[model samples]
Target: MSRLNRSRSFLWLAGTVGVTLLGSLIPLTTNNRFYYYDDTQAGAFGIWFEIGTKLSAGEWPLFSDTAWGAGNYAAEGQWGIWNPLVLLIGWLASTSPNIVVFSTVLKITCLCVLAAGTFLLAGSYKARPEWAAIAGVAVTLTGFTVYIDAASWVTGLMVFSLLPLAWFGLRRMAFAGGNPILALVAAYVLITIGYVHGTLMLAVLFLGLFAEAWLTARSRNVMFRLLLAGMVCGFIALAVYLPGVLTAPVTARTGGIANSGFLTPDLTGLATVWVPGSLPQITGWWGGFAPVPLLYVAWFLPVLAIVDYGRMWAGGKELAAIGVFGLLSLGLTLAPSDLGPLRFPIRLMPYVSLALLLGAAVLLSRYRVAVLSRGRLAVTAAIVISGLYLAWSQYPSIRMAAAFGLLSVAGIGGLYFLLFSPRAAPRLKSPAATAAGVILVSLVVAAGQHAAFKASPLPDYRMPDTPQAYSRQLPGAEGGTFVVGDPTKLGSQIWNETLASNAWYLNSAQVQNLYSPIMFAKYAEDLCITSHGWTCSSAGRKLFETDPATGKVLADLLSLDTVQILRDPAATSDDIFRDGPPAGWHESSRSADAVVWMRDRPLLNTGQVVWASDGTRLSLVSENSQEVVLRVDGLDGGSGKAVLSRLAWPGYSAQGASLAAPLRGYLVELDIPANSVGKSITLRFEPPAWPAVVGSIIIAIVVSLGWSLGELVLLRRRRPDKAWADRAMAEPVKAVSPQ
Candidate 1:
């Protein structure tokens, strides 16, 4: 391609990306609101807000006492604090006046990335830029990705968006003799996102690409470079996941496999894959059916009826590889509800959709077909009718099925005329015109889908209030605040003009009602807390009870200065306050929302040490999330133990005292030896094996960058020779074609 053509291609790709991004924002624009549903509001936003606040305040948020069982942010891993881009986004959202807007912006930006990457990947497969753009837009607005991942699971969106770029890089290096640096960098960033499902998806992608390379080229150098990339990614994975792996034993994240069928796709759903708004019978958080187009890949996918299958068959080995990969993805998506550590087979839908879209792009780009014949049009109609029938069989919503069928038929007709109609003007069949038509139709479909999704009653479309609203409603507590209530009940109060949700990280107060998928088992059990940090009604009694080992009440051990119990108007009697406030506790306030109890005397030592053995004295010298310093006395003659409020996650170390077995097998315990008792002790926490993990990551990055740069220089040096250019152009394009 000439330089001008390259420029034009870039411009077209940019235009496609912009269109996809605008289409993605339709949910926000059409609804006049952000995507603040379920996990998006309660989990991801709050964590991002906290990350930004802590980093801005010059604190590394490795642990948070406010979060209690969910305090070990590093161990949780999904926070993505290790990724620089994630940190930047978190900081930006935290500082933004309206965080909801920022969250929306971040998601749209990721959507654009997905679009751009998909476009480039299709181009690498030799698809025409226009066809590539169609694939990009289609995949960007695919059902599961847009509705489920982008709307509710931002981290999943982040990971899914990068897959195409990673594929493009790997394809270039393995087949085109392009530099491997792109592949290395993309893989590194993908793994660093710290979502296990995404990591698993990347692993599958790597294996698929590697297998394709080996079967087609069998080049030793290609195999070596691919292996090298995989190894580097492996090291980065270690750096990102080691802490979480070590901490998993104590967490609620015990992996198991089951076939309860949650988030499992029915094979029958495939019949309605092209119907944008057909809600298939699939079990999800919304219950019996998905409100969004869980199975919709693209409106144009059905246009494959008019494409030349013989030509695609003759296209070559790459197409077969893509078919195999798609099949593999389908198998996984239909796998059990839980597959080892990776749960929710439906999360793999994005990959499956990508495969199908890529295949369509390749077939369409490679084979120029005659004008749509009557027979082909008949076949298309039949396909659409069959899909509607299958969907209606399961869902029995005739109106919905009819609407989706009509839309699919209209989309197919429009696409057919744009690509192959002989009656159309010459320019109408040009690549740019074809791209414009696809983008326009895609945007319309996306907008319609967004409107439908907004109108759907399945999703709780309640928007969370601003950070300032939360801070104003719940004043900062001197010590941490312990919330005692049912999470389900409290969650419903989010939009009820109250600060009683799991988004506790939004406020200045150290509210304990935070959400985490993994919690320290013992801490959760002891406090009657669940994974989301919501405590049972009996949690109030548990809080005032004395710990046998620490000889201190749970409230004092937690250093809680305030307690908020959800006010249940229907209850016959109050549980904690019924007996009159426990000693040293008094009712400070009451409202329709909650009853607040204040501590009469706060602990003098605000650090982790809640109680110490006799003859051992400790005073808080300094403390932060990751480190603590304490002055010790009266332990010079005998051994003693001090129980810490901190959970015993894997990486804490004491300089002057050795770590004792956890008190009650949960809290951090320090054993002070006779020799080191008088010395001031410094305790610090880091992910175990930090030195090696950090070193390996840094070295892998530097070496990969250096290798890639060197290869680029060598290629450039050889590029100027006429023979080299001719030879390169003449080489059989063994590049993988999309299946």
Candidate 2:
């Protein structure tokens, strides 16, 4: 291959490997805990579990009381149905008794799909495979993104990753007219597949799509058809996920609902989590002492893209897409909503970055070297300054700063190619040669990053298995209703919102926790107060749970008090309750982390047991596979463990219990067996051994070294210079060259 052919081929190989590396790192090394931090996980996973159970029994999706029973805060609540795609995965996994393997495999699939989409997206832009691969890796390591994945925020990060690729695919179909309809159909279908987080991505996509259509008015028919196909595909995707979307409101209300006060665009700015304090200082600064930094210096290309596209609005497609994306970032960064939407949207930054980067690349591709020199320097300088500001404000580590420095230099090198050596060597003479080069680069990045990740994994962070594995018993008051709470709190790992407190209350089965909307409202208000450290007194606590309807201050009226709701009524219970000795409670045999009150409340006879379902026969192939509900006859007010050990049956263990008062009963959710009897089942839950920051560093080194080494080999064996250039642009006019 000629020199240019060799360069392109080498870059492609590095990119492929890098892409695979990125894919592996995102799923394999992620924290393997379940159901964390946001309502997204709780909603997605909870629904998945429920759907899986249903599918095993060959039943249609239906909202389950069991899932929503813990929360009394919503007007409507249920896990009736979920996105078909998620449900399908869950169903397939349910076929196996070993959930660990099932979940592991499923996650890997999601990551792989995302990786493929990312590759397609990068390819569509005609980006050097290496750069695209590196970008993918960077996107995966983004702090908020990693956190979301680790916390089981399935839709959060996964859906975000698909959007850009889908967009690229759509662009190719529309502009290039090569099975564009099929691509449009596929992209829309996926978007609507009930990936809850995709909603945000959808918003971004729509904005870009509209901009593209309006800007390219002369080609409006083509754009409109593409849009039409997209909408149709979107509908198809929705149908696939109709169950989940239809029931999401109920789940959100009862599960992870958070009401942001600033609905107006003007006020929405205040709802962002972009305060200087919220930015991750450590990882952002030092990049965990890794060679490459998360904030690459090449990111300046985005700035260049913005400026170059500023006045060049032939139609506004490119400018509009960039503009809308920038506004989105700005809005999200400014708002400080409880949902963390703004701050978390950083997960979507890669798309924005890609837009900027590609725009820069394409623009520079068409420019003369002499003209770009001055602009490139200015652009590079601005990037350095902004990067410094981000680093300083975010409080990143020195290692992180250095990583950015190196990455910045690399970006400058890329720019150097654009300005100084536009035609350093001839293009490839043959397509096969070019393709071979791309493959080589991809392998190198993939192999290198994988090695690095294995060498330095994320630190082991063990999450307590409360509702999932422990505490089968929970009390339900007779004539009293119980409420399941929002389990989304555990995602942040911040003390205030730990789900433990809520789980404990449920498992305790003490006085029936009323479904109090007022409580939710209070929780919201108290959040602000506690954040300010302004509400800590007993009075403050009482005020925090007050009911507007009854003019009743229920905080003191209720017998129960979580550390989160007392003393500093505004403080998250996490502050004082972060992993401590159990206070005023005793352990029980039937539950993991079960605690019984030392001083029991007066009883009006123990609460009566109302309902029980020990997921025993909720599987296929079992002769007695029948869903059954048990009614615990009578017991009121007493708050102690009540075991139905006598009720033990096949396919279940006799380790169920419920708190005494408010009729608490244990549920024995069963895992459907793959066969009548299968091999010894294993459940693995190993977390990474390195911190994310540290892991990121290792990834950087592997990517850089691997890319460098592979480049060296390709350079040495480059084909004749004249022969390569001919192949680089030798594609038939009908063939849609990848981005």
Candidate 3:
């Protein structure tokens, strides 16, 4: 290819990737909170927010050695295990809270990395501008992009957005027999730091890489080295991964009770990952935004890319795409979330899908001739299969099915003749024919999938509109205590102190027995004897009543120190405050939710003041505001009752009752008290942990200096003879490293 052509191709790639990234960022940035059941995505955002909060407080977000099932969503004082890279990014952005700006910057950075990587990968296939752009769009618009709920997951999504770039490098390394070891290390490390689910994805990538390398390497040592590099990265990734995995068994057990057959399907439900309509409730118009058509069509792209797959394989790229897609697909279908567990495959699928599509694009570009005809046929078949599956899944919504079914059929018919049997001389193998085929296939697939992709509606629910909203409204009272009516109670009174609102907390009459640990521990013997009613003890009542009482019981409950609550917009004065405090004294705070007066305030009547020294008579010494002295007759003999007036808080030596000092060293003594000798007391000191703080700052400085030094070395070492054009083309064609 000419230099002009290459430059144009690069420009086209830049434009396409830029546009796709911008589009993806739009929805992510706009939605302050997004609606989705994918907790992994939500967890990513939560991790970032927590890290941001921690960094703002001048602390590193360290891994806490603890796990609590119930308070996972409760932001403050929740479980604290975070991916380091994610913590680093959020910490970097802690200086500002304008999430939009932070997210935009990160998203752009991810895109630049992606584009550079793609350019390198595509250069291997000598892909044209148009073909490369198609690949870019396909990746940008895929279902994975939806994971970016801008408010919480900007960093995770940004990290995820770099997968294609990494894969591109992987491909180059394999083809050129270059030192891919470093690239492998960097890629795995970044993924590990980027998200918790990265382990699963990394697993798939490793498996794929191993398979690809073994099949292509000329020597046993090369294969061993590749596997060794992967093993090293795996060990490093495990540093963060082991903790997340440890918490999973507990998380699954706690979440298992919400397992509705419809909501949490068994083997049948697992199939829905591939088939669109199996879960119609999650269908586009219902709640799912991943259009049935789009997912279906995407699956077919790899099949169409088979022609290019042949060419790439012949050229030594190794046929890894098929193996990758197949492995991920199998895992998704078999991985259990509730049965035994929602295993690693659940996390692996999203990234695996990206590799699948990228491989397809590479193949499509290589066999441009076959892509026009055979590619269309394969895509058409895929659309048909997807449409059928979607319609089957939504069997009740037959009218909806009919509409999509007809369109899918007609699409296949139109594309079939264009490839297998053309109207005039069948301009097969011609550039124009092939180009036209590519255009038609791309349009049809995109349009078909777009039709289905538009299904996930913006959830109308907001804070207070749903149960999840309750956590958001909790606020801290003056003393850092907040009362909230638990939303789980059925027919229970909802006394939302914040906005003073009421809803049936949980309909208790409908739910007779509360299945809580407090109930089980306290009343288990009695309930077994009488076989009875809702016999809730004081602890059980605390466990059960939020606003209303929900029927089900929680095995474990983690209490919050502070909470903010939102009042229902429709609420009036009559809603929440009707019922007086239930068996407890009520004291209201200036703040709405600050009401506190439990009948049994445990610490009410129990404290004593004692003298630190036994003294007979005492004299006082007045010093600066930071010091004081007490004089006693017993100072010489050490045995007399010297009364010291206004003594300082116990720890310091009280000059008299009115004075004290915090320093431990000796001071000037006052005489006159005998009984004041040997009475012990307590004192308070407020010293900063300076050594630890200074050490952290020093480490930051060292890292910054090292990065600068490394950059200088890399710049000096860059290949001198390589031209802009040669570097641009060659960078993407050979295996590269972070150094």
Give the local distance difference test score of model 3: 0.38
lDDT of 1 by residue, 1-739 (tens): 5666556777867887888877877777666444555677767877787788889989776776546677777778888766877788778878878756777788888889998888888777767777788888888888888777877778888888988888887777767667777778777777777878778877787778777776677888778878878887888888888888887888877778888888899888877788777778888767888767888888777777877677666655666557767888889899999765567898889989999998888777766466567887898888877877887887787777676667777777777877666688998877788888877777787777776676322344364547666665445355777777753553455333334334667766666667778888877887877765667788888888888776788788777788877644445565663555778877776666667787788653444788888878888788977788888867744878888777787888999888988876777888887755557888888877778767878878887888888887798665423232122222212332322
TM-score per candidate, chains pooled: 0.91, 0.52, 0.57
When 1 and 3 are scored with TM-score, the better candidate is 1
Q: Between 1 and 3, whose lDDT is larger?
A: 1
Report the C-alpha lDDT of model 2 over 1-739, residue by residue, as the tens digit: 4677556655554554445444444434433332243333224433455456567778755322222223221111122132346567656634444434454455545555555455445444454344444444434433334433533445545566566566665565455543343354345445544443455556666676677556654486567656655555544444333333332332222344343432212221111111111123222222422222222212333334223343345422544554676567445533333352222333444444445444443333222133444555676566555555554445455654454445444544544453345474444313333334333332333333333333222222232333343234333322112222222222323222223222232233332322211122233233222211223333323323544432333322232322222222234655322223243322221212222222123222211111222322211111111123232232232222222211111112211222222111122222323231222212111112213323433443354345335535665565223232223222122221111
lDDT of each residue in 112-188, candidate 3, tens digit only: 55545554554544454444555555454444344322222343455555555555555544444334443553464
| Model 2: residues with Cα > 4 Å off, grouped in runs | 1-18, 26-46, 69-82, 95-108, 122-138, 149-151, 176-197, 230-351, 357-375, 393-400, 403-407, 410-739
TM-score-based ranking, best first? 1, 3, 2
Residue 558 in candidate 2, Cα distance off native in Å: 16
RMSD of 1: 3.8
For each candidate in turn, give its C-alpha RMSD to the true structure in angstroms: 3.8, 16.0, 13.2
Error of 2 at 700 (Å): 44
Clashing pairs for model 1 are 359-739
When 1 and 2 are scored with TM-score, the better candidate is 1
- Residue 470 displacement (Å), model 1: 2.5
